[model samples]
Target: STIAERRPERIAGLVYLCALLQPSGATPADLHRHDPDSALVAAIEMAPDGSATSIRPDAAAELFYGDCRPEDVRTAIERLVPEPIGPAMSTIDTSAERWGSVPRAYVRCDRDRAIVPAEQDRMIAEVGVDVVVEMASSHSPFLSQPDALAAALVEIRDGTA
Candidate 1:
């Protein structure tokens, strides 16, 4: 769904989840799933429409499990779950918030399909992210650009970026 189309509660909730995914095996794909340990999935369960959630895997699990399909975890999770909104739900207001106070530093994958630069730009701007470094690669930057991604991490740790 378009970010603009989602209810405010959902939007605000997603921000918190993004922060959660940042630390918990936050590969590009991991940040977008419905894992039990995932902050995003937690937020979803708390959402009014989330009572129908059935296959929740812990976000920080070493490996994925349960009845979740690849599509259910990342791209079309809401589609996979049942809805409680009845015929129609009200649009959410603008009270969204992410779960972060620190600045963000990224090892971007220039060729990423799941997450593009435009979307990342918006996310960083909204989250007040302070550092960003891009690299040529696919959605899985660690796999496609490990050395560059690693260097960026070192920079983030050393406060050099």
Candidate 2:
């Protein structure tokens, strides 16, 4: 959404896949903090120097890959890295003239723990997407349900979603 807002002319549409969809002037941190159902919030560990944040490794499965295969979950956990705090803390500036003009779509993961279903619904209601494709998968649908995710993306691209 922020990217579309900043470069609306270059973007054809916006697709959020179990991703952050906060409103203008709202940061990712702000949204997570407000969402009581978000498992990620409890798992978040700030860096000692306050430069980055990472989830507790032990909480990875429940927070991110609850519906995923065991091996896939292990691999994803192995690949996890600390996310810089700057971007999550930065508030985006959006307007109807820019971000609102682009057709937006959301692929809501019903089984997502990081961003729970209630939070997903709240964001969709607030941001107003053109379409929403729900999946009975985890937050990492690309790993757990790639075919369905790809199909939804194709549908969004073809304007048939």
Candidate 3:
């Protein structure tokens, strides 16, 4: 059963699935042809300030914020925090009832190397969002193009988009 099927309650407001990589009925391995582990930064040690630190800074930059500047990448790495990547989060619910009734928008990052444009397109097509906004940014648009992201969010919030 899907969330919608189980809950059967309409969402009060809009939902934003930004830079989504995996669509319904797909996995991260489906997007990356090769071993996904190889692309991951091997040593993500925790800093004294409780922030995540990457030993392979270059690789992390390329993976997370490919469109960001060198200085921005350094700042992002320094401020990075640990995040959970659980199996349930990666899994997508294809049930129409749960997702179809909700108002949703997608923010596509064109230069996102982590998710890639093709995968993003697949999700947009499969899930079917109310609005589609494009940004010339990497995976981490919040760091690369925060202003644009904020504008899009505002538009969605105001229902003017």
TM, every model: 0.40, 0.95, 0.66
Please, what are the lDDT tens digits per residue for candidate 3 over residues 89-110? 3655556656566667778878
Better of 1 and 2 by TM-score: 2
Q: Candidate 3: global Cα-lDDT?
A: 0.64
- Candidate 2 local accuracy as lDDT? 0.90
Q: Tell me the tens digit of each residue's lDDT in model 2 across 1-161.
A: 77898889999988999898989999998898767656688899999999999999999988888878999999999999999999998999899998899999999999988998998999999878999998999889999889888999999999888
TM-score result, candidate 1: 0.40
Output the TM-score of candidate 2.
0.95
The order of the candidates by lDDT, greatest first, is: 2, 3, 1
Off by over 4 Å in 2: none
Those runs of model 3 whose alpha carbons end farther than 4 Å from true positions after fitting are 1-10, 13-18, 21-57, 79-85, 88-94
For each candidate in turn, give its C-alpha RMSD to the true structure in angstroms.
13.0, 1.1, 5.5
- Candidates in order have lDDT scores of 0.41, 0.90, 0.64
TM-score of 3: 0.66
